[model samples]
Target: MNRTLLIIAMFCSASTFAQSPVINNAEIDGSGAQYQGNLGVNQAAGDLQQQANARAIAVGHGASATTQIRQRLRTVVDPRIDARSSIQGDSFSHGNGVLGVNQSAGASNQQANAVRISIGTQPQSIDDSVLRQQNVTLIINSDPTDSEPGYRQIATSDQAFTGSRGVIQLNQSAGVGNRTANTLSVRVTD
Candidate 1:
C-alpha cells in the first residue's frame, strides 16, 4: 500500500512541473506614464527629458588566452562625471551619447597605466546585476600617470568677473603621482 501511494504522489508532482511559464499581467509605471508591456517611457520632468547612461560590466573569465581567467577588475585616471541642469524642457530634447572621444583639446591628455586588477572569484552558483535610477551621472577623469614632475610654473594671474545668478564652479587640479575620484551626487528634489 505504501509503495502504491509513493507512485501516485510522483505522478501528481510530475504533472504540476510540466506546465508552461506565464505572467498574468506585465506592467511598468512611472511619473506621467504607464506601460502594460515593455516598450518605452518619457521622463516628464523635462519638456523633453534627455538622458544618457554609460555602463560596462564583465563577469566570468576571458575565454581567449590560455587557461580561462576567472575574473579581472580595473579602473583608470582622475575619473570625473559632470553636468548642470536647470533649463526648462524643450518641445523635444534628444541626446547623442558616444563611447569614444578622439581629440587633442577635450580628452586629449589621458594616460592609462597597467590597470591589472582582481576583485574576487564568483561563487559556483551566483548572479550579478546593476541598476541605476534617474539623473545619475558618473565622471572619471585626472592624471593616469601618478608621477610628479619637478617642473616650475610661471606666476599666473587670476581673472575676476561679476555674476548675477550666483556662480557655482568646481575647479580641480591634480599634480603628478596623484589619484583623484570625483562624484557629484544629488538626491531627489521636489
Candidate 2:
C-alpha cells in the first residue's frame, strides 16, 4: 500500500515539527468604540502574546498630583479655607523591569501634597524567551493667593517587550500656574 502510505507520511511530518507553539486565539473587540490605544503579538517559530484593553486614563514613569481652594472677607478679615490633593502610579513586567513616580505642592497659609509608585519583574519560562515591561508616574503641585500664585505637575511612563525580546517606554507631564504657567510633556524611548 505504497509502503504503508510512506511510513504514515514520515510520522506526520515529525509530529508537526516537534510541536510547541500555542496561543490558540487572541482577540480585541470593541463595539461602539471610543478609544483603543496599544496592542502587540508575535509568532514565527518563537511565541509571544500580549493584550492591554480599555484605558481611559494611563500614566507612567515619574508621577504626582495637587489641588486647592481659599477665600477671604474684608476689614475684620474672615478666612475660610478648603484644600485638596492627589497622586497615583503603576508598573508591570515579566523580566527585567523598573518604574517610578513623585508629586508635591505648597501654599502661603500652607497646603502641600505628594504621590509616588514603582514596579518590576524578571525570569520567565515556557520556551524561555519573553521580557515585558511597563512603567507610569505623575506629579501635580498648586499654590494660590490673591488668585495669582499657583502650580500643577504631571508625569508618566509605559513599555511592552516581546519574543526576539521587545521593549517600550512612555512618559507625560503637565504643570499649570501664574495665569497658566502651562507645561505638558511626553517621551517614548524604545
Candidate 3:
C-alpha cells in the first residue's frame, strides 16, 4: 500500500512542527491598579507651677478712762496648680507594589490594553515600558498647640508596572496569495 502511505505522511508532518502557537480570529485585553497610604502622630512631656503670700499686724493704746486698748493680727496663704500628659511615641508606615502584564496574541481583528494606577507623594521610582499605567500616593502629619507639645511621623510607598501587545493578520482569496508570521513578548517581575 505504497509503503504504508509513506509512514502516514511522515507522522503528520512531524506533528505540525511540534505545535505550540495558536491564535485564530482573536482579541485580548488586560488591566492592573495599585494604591498606598500612611499617617502617624505622637507626643510626651511633663510640667507644673504654683505660688502664695500674705501678712498684717497692728497695735494701739491710749488713756482717758481706759478708752483705747486694742491689738490685731492677720495672715493668709494658698496657691498650687499642675497639669501633665503623655502619648506613647506615635508612628505609621505604608508600602505598595504593582506589576501589570498584558500580553496580547496575534490574529485577525485583534485588540489589547493594560493599566496600573497610584496617586500622591512618591511611588518607588517608576519606569514605564510602552507606558501601560501607574499611580501612587502617601501623606504624613503631626500637630500640637498650647505652648508646643511633641510629635513624630513617617510614611512610605512603592509601585511597578509592565505591558505588551502583539497583533498579526493573514487573509487571502481575492487573488489567492497571503501568508504571515508574528511574535510578541512582555515581562515584569520583582
Candidate 4:
C-alpha cells in the first residue's frame, strides 16, 4: 500500500509539471486595492508594409484574361481591464500616481495596397519613379510640475486613476503613409 501511494503521488506531480502554464498578452491585477507608483511603458515600431498585386495580359487577337487582387489589414488593440470591488471596500482610495502608456505601433506603416493591371496592347511607354523617406522622433517627460497642468495632462489623467494622478498617454504615428488604430482606457469601480 505504501509503494502504491508513492507511485500515485509521483504520477500526479509529474502530470502537474507537464501541464502548460497560463499566459496572458496584457498585464492584469485582480486584487482590489489602491496602487501607488510610477509607470512608464513604451511600445514603438519602425516600419511595416502589407501589399498585394496581380496582373493579366493577352497578346493574341481573340484573347481573354482575368486578374484579381485582394488585400486586407486589420489591427485590434482591445484590452480587457476589470477592477471591480468584490466586497464593499474603499474603491476610491487611489493615491498620487504617474502613469504613461505610449503606444507607437509604427512610423511608416503601409497597409491594404492592392493593384491590378490588365493590358491588351503590345507596345507602350512606361515611366515610374518611387522615392520614400521616413523620420520619427518621440520625447516623453513625466517630471512632476507644480504649475498648472494643460489639456494634455488633464486628458491623460482622466483616463487613468482618480485622485491627484498625473498620467501621460501619447499615441503617435509619424512619417508618411501611416495607418494605425489606438485604444487606451482605465476604469475604477466602486
Find the candidate with the highest lDDT and give its number: 4
Residue-level lDDT for 3 in candidate 2: 91
Q: Model 3, range 112-166, lDDT digits (tens) per residue? A: 2222222323223334332221212111223333333122121111211222121
Ranking by lDDT: 4, 2, 1, 3
Error of 4 at 130 (Å): 37
Model 4 ranges with Cα > 4 A deviation = 1-35, 45-95, 108-164, 167-169, 172-190
Give the candidate number with the greatest TM-score: 4
As a TM-score, model 3 comes out at 0.16
Lowest summed lDDT across 10 adjacent residues in model 1 is found at: 99-108
- Candidate 2 has an lDDT of 0.23
lDDT of each: 0.22, 0.23, 0.21, 0.32
lDDT of 3 at 151: 25
Per-prediction tally of clashes: 12, 29, 5, 0
In candidate 3 the C-alpha lDDT for residue 40 amounts to 13
The digit string of per-residue lDDT tens for model 1 on 1-190 reads 9999999999989977896532111111211111121111211110112222222323344311111111112323222311111112221122122111111111112111111112234323221212222222223444466644332121111221111121111111122222211112121211
- The RMSD of every model to the true structure, in order and in angstroms, is 26.1, 27.8, 41.3, 23.0
Error of 1 at 5 (Å): 99
